[model samples]
Target: MKIKVINKGHHALPEYQTELSAGLDLRAVLSESKVLAPLERVLVPTGLYIELPQGYEAQVRPRSGLAFKHGLSVLNAPGTIDADYRGEIGVLLVNLSNEQFEVKDGERVAQLVIAKHETVEWEPVETLSDTERGAGGYGSTGKK
Candidate 1:
């Protein structure tokens, strides 16, 4: 499933670390290091533009190492990139720690996962079928 991509910066293309890895590491393409204060968020560009096939979408997710070590995370975890979008990829990052975090050029910031999605059609019905846990909201099930 090779997709078309355009690299507009000097950084290497995003790649999976292992053979079975589902996501590719995305890097930040910054001119200079940007300091992010606690609770601050910024949009970091990747200088990558991709063309995904129809019914497939790209999801921008956080790197677990960055999130657990530096308290940095993708603001919109699993940010969706539609198949029709042709703009550069940007990662929305937020600092959740007390200390300021610096975003350096070509630093791995996020992970991108290509996913297949289904298009739903309107199946209007008078009422939905009922089950034992029908209409149950969040946490309706026991914690155990």
Candidate 2:
């Protein structure tokens, strides 16, 4: 699906790294390097604006390599960008490791995944249907 986007940053528009990739790498737009101290979090802008059709959303997710190698993560994993939103895309980044992480311009910091969703209306039901594992959650199912 083709999407309409406005890129105000210096870097090129986000693109899929491979043919079968489900997400596009989102680059950081910054004037200077920003240090992320351990256990600290910051909102990093992408200088991008998008116009998504109804029933669709853009998910902001963490880069796996950055999360694994540098203990960096998107604070709000899978942050949702609604179809009606028309503002700069920003990623909430958090440093989960002990060492500091430097965020530079054009650095791949997050992934953007466009997804289609359904809008549900509440039925105001009296009770939900019973299930085999009703009300069982939070590790209620034993691990293998």
Give the clashing pairs for model 1.
none
Error of 2 at 71 (Å): 0.4
What are the TM-scores, per candidate, against the unseen true structure? 0.97, 0.96
lDDT of each: 0.96, 0.96
RMSD versus native structure for model 1: 1.2
| lDDT tens readout by residue for model 2, 31-96 | 998999999999999999999999999999999999999999999898999999999999999999
The reply for model 1, stretches above 4 Å from the true place, is none
Give the clashing residue pairs of candidate 2, or none: none
Model 1: per-residue Cα lDDT over 35-87, one tens digit each: 99999999999999999999999999999999999999999888999999999
Report the CA-based lDDT of candidate 1 relative to the real structure: 0.96
